[model samples]
Target: MTNSWSYSSTDNLWKPPATIIRSLINCVSKNGNLLINVCPDGNGIVPEQAVETMREVGAWMKKNGESIYGAGAADYPTPEWGRYTQKGETLYAHVTDQPIGNISLRGLRGRVREGRLVATNTDVLICEYWNPEVQTLDGPEDIFFNFARPTAWTYPLPDESATVVAFRLNDDEGTRTERQRLDEVRMRI
Candidate 1:
């Protein structure tokens, strides 16, 4: 719990701008909530930086709050690009790190209804193509553009907190992709 005034004791613990947002995303991904602490002087007035930070957070919440409020941990393999939050039949993908190319939701081929970015202007390409999960003879797996006729997508990242890719989870897909996040969102590492 911290506020605008970076405590004199520990300055490394907190930072402004998207600190709250980043913390909120991280905590929410792990099924936790962020309790912020804001301190004021003798007067009841909140600090200016605190207020500004809140305004920014509020702006982000206005468009993407649906993915956070009343949401829970997504029952799927964590994506390297970002995190996941599920509410009811909707799976919200909170993309923090930017992706390179095609974003693939492996098991979700035909179970998807409609994808609404609802935040940024980036083009979201949801096509029926399966980018085969490659397995090289070396050691680590190379996950990249699987431009097949199955599952592959691409959504650019946002400037603020995260870029939410909301997918309507159908009843049929419930058993298959349970908590299984979208496969690969980027082509390159």
Candidate 2:
């Protein structure tokens, strides 16, 4: 509980903006909803700290609300770096941690039409044909996207709260490559 019905000195455990935002994203991704209770003091005044926290959350929502509102649980499982939420053919990747390399979406059966950072609308690399040898052995096609930067250099994420990457999917679902099929046949033979 963030606050009580009435103000108490020790009742509130104030969560940081990042924690609140991350919680909101995780709940939305898992086909769940979060209900926050904001209690006012005896004078019917909201706490300044609570208001500030909400302001930060509201700011993040102003930019990345599309990912949460009207979104359903993604067809795929959650990735190491973050969770995924889908609306129609589009999948939103809520990256909570700094990715070591490219953000990989394993077993993503949807073809990516485009991808971009939700906050800045900056284009991220959507490599469908990346690492053909590795992908062939993996069986299913994986979608990889992120700023193609060297891992040696430390780069800050666009938003520490949660950087959202929007991936517009195609109507045609992903499939195994011909090479993979041939390899399977060979193994069976």
Highest TM-score among the candidates is held by which one? 2
Give me the runs in candidate 2 sitting further than 4 Å from their true place.
1-6, 128-140, 149-154, 173-189
Candidate 2's residue-wise lDDT over 76-175, tens digit each?
7788988899998889999889875556778763566678998889887654433432444352566566565431233567788899999888765446
lDDT of 1 by residue, 1-189 (tens): 352453333333435656677778778878899877766546666656667888888898887888889988887767777777888888887777766555656445545655667575343455333333452212112222222223334433555467787877676644544224233223321
How big is the RMSD of model 2? 6.3
lDDT of 2 at 159: 86
- Taking all chains together, each candidate's TM-score versus the true structure is 0.66, 0.79
Off by over 4 Å in 1: 1-14, 120-123, 129-156, 173-189
RMSD of each: 7.4, 6.3
